[model samples]
Structures are given as C-alpha cells and as structure tokens.
Target: MKYLNLALLILFPVAWFAPLLRAALLPIFGMDEISVITGLQSLWGSDPAFALLVTFLAIFAPFAKTLGLALIHFGLLSPKTLPALHILGKLAMAEVFLIALYLIIAKGAGYVTIETGWGLYLFTVCIIVSLFISHKTETS
Candidate 1:
C-alpha cells in the first residue's frame, strides 16, 4: 500500500502534463488537443474567472493535496493537517472534465468528433488512487 501510494504520487503530475483531450474538426481540416495547462490557458482568453477557478481546482489543489498527503505518509507533516487537506481534496472538483465532456458531446451531436485521450484516463486514475490513499491513510 505504501508503494502504491508513492507510485501514485509520482504519476499524478505526469498525468497532469499529458494530453487530456483531443478533437478533430470537420472534414479533417484541423485537429486540436490540450493538456490541463493548455486547456486553462485557452479558457483564460474567454473567461478569466472561470479559468482561474478551474486552474485552482484542477491544478493547484491537486498538487497541494498530493504534497500534503506525501508529507503525511512520510511522517513529515502532522496528522492534524489531514483534516484540512481532506476538506481541500473534497473541494477539488473535476468539473473541468465534465465541462469538457459536455462540450464534446454537444458539438459531436452534429458536426465534431471528439476522442478521449490517455491523459484523461490517467488523470482520472490519479484522482481515484489518491482518494483511496487518503481514505486508507486517514483510517489507519
């Protein structure tokens, strides 16, 4: 279990940097793909506040949670930190992912083609594994 947690700690950032989504425009004229960072940057041009919120939730929050967990796992941080970290983790909404999926489905309803990228799967795995690790740590 310790090893699993450590492995997931390493994987979370890799998943974050990976391409999370891909879209193929009509007639194959253009193909676009984005990672979380790129997605946030793109959104910034349109809605800065939404983009900032997503960035905080999707990027900063996870990074901080993982770091906090790692500290706890390694006996560096006090267990007292766990409660606060847990709350933060709970608020680390994956709404950005849902919005991306909604856009894909809505667009593909008629004209566009969207592909689920490995990054999305990887990031999701990170989230689930992290949750499990957190629960296990908290309980034990």
Candidate 2:
C-alpha cells in the first residue's frame, strides 16, 4: 500500500502535464493537446471560480489524500484522518467525470474534433490506484 501510494505521488504529476485530449476548434488549425495543466491555465483566464473548483478536484484532492496517507504510513499522521482522505479521493474522481462530460458536449456540437489521449487513462489510473490505496490503508 505504501509503495502504491508512492507511485501515485510520482505519477500524478506526470498525468497532469501529459496530454489528456487532442482538440481542434476548427479543421484549419491543427489539433492542440490539452493536459490538466493546460486546461487549468486557459480555464483560469475565462473562469476563475470554475478554475478554482477544478484545481481543487484535479490537483489538491487526490494529491493531498495521498500525501496524508503517506504521512500516516510513516507514523507522522493519525490514521483517524483516513476517512477524510477517502472523501478527498472521491472528490478527485469527479474531475474525470467532468472531463468526459465536457468532451461529450463538445463533440455533440458537431463543429469540434475531440480525441482522447493516453494521459486520460493515466490520470484515471492514478485516481483509482489512490482510492485503492486509501481503502487498503483503512483496512489494514
């Protein structure tokens, strides 16, 4: 469980910078790769409130939960905090749903092209692995 949590700590950042989507607003322009970091960057310019929400879910929740769990594993934190960490993991998972929902809406518009990137899978895997690690930590 400790090792898995550690792996998530490293992989989460990689997932953030990796391309989660390739999107082209118009065919004249080449598709641009969008990672979590890039998406958040643009989002902040247009909608700071929504960007704050996404940043919490996409960046803070999972990473904090993982770090908190690591602290517990290393005897630096109370295991009593595990339940709160579990909630954080669940919140992080919601970001994936939001991404998918946006993709569906954008594709439905019939004017944009959207393609899933490997980073989507990687991000999702990191979320799930963190959730599993949380569960295992709680159980053990």
Candidate 3:
C-alpha cells in the first residue's frame, strides 16, 4: 500500500501537467489542447478570484493531501493528524474534472467540437486512487 501510494504521489504531478482537454474551433483550423496550468492561466486572465480558488482546490489541496498521506504512511506524522488530512482531501473535490466534462458535453451539444484528453483521465485516476488510499488508511 505504501508503495502504491508513493507511485501515485509521483504520477499525480505528471498527470496534472498533461493536456486535459482539446477543442477545435473549425475543422480546417486545428485543435488546441489545454493543460491544468494553461487552463488556470487562461482563467486568471478572465477571472482572477475564480482562478485562485481553483488553484487552491485543484492543485494545492491534492498535493498537500498526497504529501500528508505519505508522511503519515511513513510515520512522520502522528495518526492524530489523519482526520485533519482526510477532511482536507475531501475538500479537494475534483472540480476540474467535472468542469472539463461539463465543457465537453455542453460544447458538443452545440456546434462546437471538444474532446477530453489523456490528462483528464489521468487526473481522475489520481483522485480516485488518493481517495481509495485515504479510505483504506482510515479503515485500517
């Protein structure tokens, strides 16, 4: 379990950096892919406050949760810290994933062409794995 958590912890960042969505404005023109970093940057230009909130929830929260889990797993942190970390992890809901899915479906429902990319799937995997580990640790 420790090794699995460690592997996921390392992979999370890689997944975060990958492109999460791709959309084409016109069939003749080309598709533009957006990663989490790029999406946040774009959001910042349009809405700073929203972007900041997303950064805290989608990026910092998960990173912190993973780090906290690792520390607890290795006995670097007391088990007493587990509940706090668990709450933090819960607060780190996968808003980005839901947003991306919404955009894809909503746009596709119209005339736009949008598709989910590997990054979104990878990000989803990270969320699920992290949640699973947290639940397992809590039970054990």
Q: Number of the top candidate by lDDT?
A: 2
Q: Which candidate, 2 or 3, would have the higher TM-score against the true structure?
A: 2
lDDT of 1: 0.76
Q: Write one digit per residue (lDDT tens) for candidate 3, span 9-110.
A: 788788778988787776468788888888889989999998998888778888788888888899998878888878777766666556666685759666
Cα lDDT of model 2 by residue, 47-89, tens digit: 9999999999999998999999999999999999988998998
What lDDT score belongs to each candidate, Candidate 1 first?
A: 0.76, 0.93, 0.80
After superposition of all CA atoms, the RMSD between model 2 and the true structure is 1.0
Best by TM-score: 2
Worst 10 residues of 2 by lDDT: 1-10
Q: Estimate candidate 3's alpha-carbon lDDT, on a 0 to 1 scale.
A: 0.80
lDDT of 2 at 61: 96
lDDT of 1 by residue, 1-140 (tens): 66777787678778777887677667377768777778888889999998888888887776687788888888899988988888767766464466466666757577777666788888877777777888888999
Model 1: CA > 4 A from native = 96-108
Candidate 2 deviant stretches above 4 angstroms: none
Give me the displacement of residue 60 in model 3, in angstroms.
Answer: 0.7
Compute the lDDT for candidate 2.
0.93
Q: Rank order by lDDT, top first?
A: 2, 3, 1
